[model samples]
Target: MAETRKFLSVETISLIVAFAILAFAGFVTARTEQQRRESGAWVRHTLVVESALYRLDGAIRRAESEERGYIITRDRAYLRPKDEIATQLEKGLAEVGALVADDSEQAERLSELRPLIEERLEQLQHKIDIMRAGDFEAAAEIVRTGEGKALTDRIDALVAEMIAQEDALHRQRDLQMSEATDTLQTAIGSLIVLIAGVAVLAVLLTERQLHALRKSSESLKLAYNELIAESTKRGSLEAQLRQSQKLEALGHLAGGIAHDFNNMLGVIVSSLNILRRKLRRNEGGLDPLIDSAMDGADRAAALVRRLLAFSRIQPLNPEPLDVNSLVIGMSAILHRTLGAHIHLATVLAPDLWPTRVDANELESAVLNLAVNARDAMPTGGQLTIETQNTELDACYTDENPSVRPGQYVMIVISDTGVGMPPDVAAKAFDPFFTTKPIGKGTGLGLSQAHGFATQSNGHIKIYSEVGRGTCLKLYLPRYLEDSEAVEAPPQPQPQPPEEEFPRGRPGEIVLIVEDDEKARQATAQGVRELGYTVLEAESGKEAIRLLRARGDISLMITDIVMPEMDGARLAREAVFRRHALHVMFITGYSQHAIARDGMLDPDVNLLTKPFSLAQLARKIRDVLDARGDLPKGKP
Candidate 1:
């Protein structure tokens, strides 16, 4: 009886101890689970706050961008999303504020950020309103004050601080969640140890809890990955913005330098022409000096043209061109240019698509490439020019951002010469970059080609291997014809001898409008020497005044770009006053008056500056004689 009684007591004690252990483990697990849920909620809240901040920042940036675009372009399309952006900004800011309400520091940052954001938005709206009122200068003045930027910088700083705070909270919550998970796991282990008969059940329960924890961890990992992706995307956008700014600065620099240099060259060339004309009959030794000076001026003018081309602001005259026919026409010139040592070949595709491009620029680009290829093949090599119909799909255009997905006429120039390495080829099209010996290259050839291609809405790429030679592919968009009305390319006209200068007829008067004093005098003197009466004005207003006073003016040649009243407006006013007054535009660089999208309007009668006397004479004569107004006995 005593042994049985002792056994019963021990059994009861074991059961009681097991029950107590299970109850303790369950209680600990419940508490740990509660802590983990709280931590998870905090983590999600932080993510929400971060996401709202990003959206707010993005909305403000978009609004600012649209505002600037409207100010510059005055296009209503930029303002189309104003209401949508406003909504997003309002919603994003409210969400962020509500989410960060619990944190005092975050709430303080938000409070500071709210006023700045409101001020920025208000400033943006004010500038936009000013732009709408057609007061561009006023809007520009406001931008130049740096007030908007200051507000934006402060907003960015506050947002950064808020995000930093959220990140810290997220980390802390994650650590707490990890600790809770560890504690729950330890409690599960203890429960299994105390309850041996229900070991399988405890293990199964532990597995379920572990699975839930793993799923939560995965969610956190995914959120982290998304954050990393956003950061990377922002970095890429910043890089692209920097590149765009650099290119814009370079363009401005190139344009200013080219304009100034062109004016100087014009003075030298025109003065030289006047001096040569005054001494034409004498057999003086000055002929050689004059010829050399003229040659140098012409070379300088060519360089200026290249610079303009590189800046992508040169005036282009695009015509429907058949690439195959163009290649065939240039065969003789290519043969001469490549020399006898180099073998030139062509693979012209039949029935190729026609593209609209500036024929002269295309010819120049081809010549430049041929010269580069010849230099690459010092000893002698085969050069091939091929044409084909190509299609650039999304896959290709995705890799090349400058290109669009569409049909293109591909011009392939390949050389069996010494090729370029990867590093050298990468920068092959950069202006002023060259691998040739000094004095052998200007380094603008490839860059000019690149700019020309881009300006024409085309793309160019170079492929090379160190040992295998190089290939350059130029893609031009295919021209779409309307109603089967394809215009044939204009043939080149034969030039008259340089000595032949077409003189003006009796009663024909030429009025010259120029901004520069020396250039004006030089032009007036040249026109007078061409046997025509001349008038000069220093500005467009003066030119208009001249036109109002003089009704017998046969031709009014004006600079396209001028302060206050531009040439186009002046021309309109002049034509309104005198219906018969002929208008001509001359410019050191292209302006919006005569050019659109970097192309000269087809109907515009324009003459580029730094022109030789012969070119000037011919252009003037052509404009005068276009209406058959030339008098008898006029050369």
Candidate 2:
């Protein structure tokens, strides 16, 4: 028995486990490396194929364009680019052929694509040759036959097929790569778990042996220590894995919903504008109806904004603000919204630090929190808004990895309503995870608040119990540098009367470029009514042609999103030609254009969609009135 036990001793078992781990790690590394090489090849192949397809399309288009130019202007110089583009296209196709040499199916597709492109190019060349031969009528007849267009369309379809194949191949390779990565992660995780389990098992077996052999107490203690250490490490790793999974799920949700919602909102906003205008022109006594409609539209807009915030897609226009003052200013609105049944109070620190944040977004976040509290208390409750200057130390940051250790302005909203249970409170920040009945609440309030705080380099947390109360704390980083100076409460400026507002200057030709017909005509009519000469185009390309044909244009008011050419690109081209051209961008919704990540460009004047007629009038007046000497490309 003693001889048999020697082979199963703890030291021997440890050595065997160590060798197993090393061998397993080596196997995983080799497999991962092979998959990586395969993935890289697929990526390169896809890129080369895509590049060839685009070049082929471009070359075909150029040949047709040159054919038209020679036919129209009878200039042989137009034919020069055709040869050059063809040469480049051949080189691109050669590259793609080499890339797909390993895939027979794709190579066959490439084979089909090359001939179609050549055939189309040859047809275009034939027309040019005929035109150069002084048979203008024959060339014109050939062009009229539409044969070149037919051939080019066939070439495009073939190239698209080849591209689709490559894309499918790329997706396949990506899926394989993902599987490899997941496998590697699983192997590594399993290795760790195995090591911990083996260590615990060895310790247990060793302890049992120690007791049978009547070994020293110190030996038993050592074995127990090993088990405890492995268990603790395993628990930590599991917690981290769960956290990573949660974040990945949240990212998927954010990406899935925002774009479609924004587009629908755009249609709603534009239709609303048209309705409001028609109502104003006639005394339909529909003022209340319009106002009510506007209110609902505004509320819908707010909901969209909140969704954007939760997704972290909402851009921020941060400005320095005194924390106490911002709260004080909102106190009145907060009280009104809270109603008489709920008591509102503020416990602001006199020396609270100022912070830089998007004032409107911050105000919205506070209001959301208040509204959420109101819902929680149907029978009435005390609502307190408190602000304090505080510092988060290393100890706090260590536990909350998302938070930074620095000076922060803490805004706490407390309520005496029935608080959330521990389980409910845990998931309070998840987007659209609401507890209220249908149509009563959007689970976005807390999520948006959380997103805003984090994006602004701050943090947020919640504390609640089943019945006692609830408190939500928002930690926003305090401004450490020069900030907005504390000033006396501002006096409300009287708005200019309807007739007092600036009107468009006479003969100041304003170009309106908008893709939506309803939106474009509405804008054009509004500017024309303002006494300015207005030129309207439904696309950016048309606007460009107009810009070139007319030099009297003083302002270009364009929607940032359009087909063929976007407003920004148009403005850039227009500005390049006319450096003093004034441009204004308006958009209903976009993740890009005139703004990035919700922050508006200071250099370009911007007006959001669903704007009133008065707002448009004032913006145009302001742009035209300003010294037009600002640098170009600023938009």
Candidate 3:
């Protein structure tokens, strides 16, 4: 191949050079053609604008000429021509307006032209009428020396301005054409030079074949690195997606648990309340037991709240929470949890960036984690609680399965106690996977912590070694975003047993909008016992049907989570049908019934179900009071 290259004929080399020249010419030709087409479009647009202005100028001139001709002739024939001129001028003015109305300068000129045309037309018509009446001297005086002449002069001025404008535009177009031609010439010359330079470069650069390949090899390495980076990013995203899927699965699990637990709590509380109310009614004694049962029910409520927190199903009411303040607030609780033997030390990062997290949930996670740390050190060891800023990039997230690349405030709880094995630590966040004796420790502690962190848009990473110690890093994502001001808690309004809430009021028309058969009857029956006329319905459909039948209803009490028709839907139908209707929703699944999506009308009320007789009565009375005071709308 080397011998063949060296012995190449001069004629063959000439032929190669000629072909190279042709390729260069082709590229230049294509670019020139594109520029020429663009220039033609610009020229066409300028011509259209100029043509419109010229038409206006011509119309004004023709009107003035016709007026002068009629004044001089004093003939009826001149009157016909004047009318012809007026009609033609009006049509021309309208045509030009349609074309150049979008141009501001032109639009202003057109506005000026309007008054001139009106004055000139009126004056010329007066002169023409005089001329037709055989009053040549008077008509000529009006045309030449009166307001007619002034009007005609203004019209003539407008025509002159229009002509000047068009002439200026034509000159500008000529300049643009000259500029484009010059630019095209320069571009063609530069392109030829660049093509020659490329040809020379291609020849000179090819001489050192190995060196050229070496540079190409370096470029290939760079490209390979870029590909690896892209692959790594893809890998990191896939892992995050998997974590998101896991969390979604967890959300579903939490919802199911919350549903059953809420129902149990509801039953427990309701039954206790019913028993106490009955005892009071019957004049039976046993107040202490009743009080104890109430206390137990309250405790059960707290326990349910904790379960909801652990599952992250409970809405995170994140506020602008200060980390230092939170840690300080938790100091007493942490110390009490760790006990006297364990040396509880807190190393909070100074000027620490604050994160938006549910303060209550944060406190729970910290306290639980500290207690776990205390338990790990049976022989007594130091426990350090440290907080610092953390930024996880793609590289870091790729290695850590649960973590995503983002900002966080890392709260590490390190213990000097007997540490966990790697295998044990791996399953630390798995629910009910604890090594402690039965009844000693609930496996939900660490699991709950992990869930809370993830729920707060962060992750928990635990590192441990069998004999050394455990370092549990709880990454709570840094939330710097501002949220809308949380509205004040709705003041509980206990209604009198007469009007609004269907469950409490007696004699008031109560519309039961519950879909569940058992719940609907219980609620309707309980309302009826309160002396309020209970209207029963198993669904929103039946509730609405009942409501339509009765026009005297004061309040509508509906369970939001209905099968055929939800409470909100029924409430809307009720309000539309009966303008004065008040609504109060009762639901077992409060989140499902009254989520962000389930926005009930502001006039409507909300009452969570499994409520007591007193609660039911009070709510009804309060809602009724509010409804009573509302201003009446025009009938």
Models, CA RMSD each: 42.1, 38.7, 29.5
What TM-score goes with each of the models? 0.38, 0.36, 0.33
Runs off by more than 4 Å, candidate 3: 1-295, 481-635
Query: What is the number of residue pairs that collide in model 1?
Result: 0
In angstroms, give how far residue 188 of model 2 lies from its true place.
60
Candidate 2: residue 410 Cα off by (Å): 0.8
List candidate 2 stretches off by more than 4 Å. Answer: 1-283, 286-289, 482-635
Candidate 1: give the clashing pairs.
Answer: none
Each model's C-alpha lDDT? Answer: 0.78, 0.76, 0.68
Task: Report how far residue 115 has shifted in candidate 2, in Å.
Answer: 99
Ranking by lDDT: 1, 2, 3
- Clashes, model 2: 2
Number of clashes recorded per candidate: 0, 2, 10
Better of 1 and 3 by lDDT: 1
TM-score of 3: 0.33
| Candidate 1 ranges with C-alpha deviation above 4 Å | 1-283, 484-635
Task: In candidate 3, list every pair of residues with a backbone clash.
Answer: 494-618, 495-618, 495-619, 495-621, 495-622, 496-621, 501-620, 506-531, 506-532, 507-532
lDDT of 2: 0.76
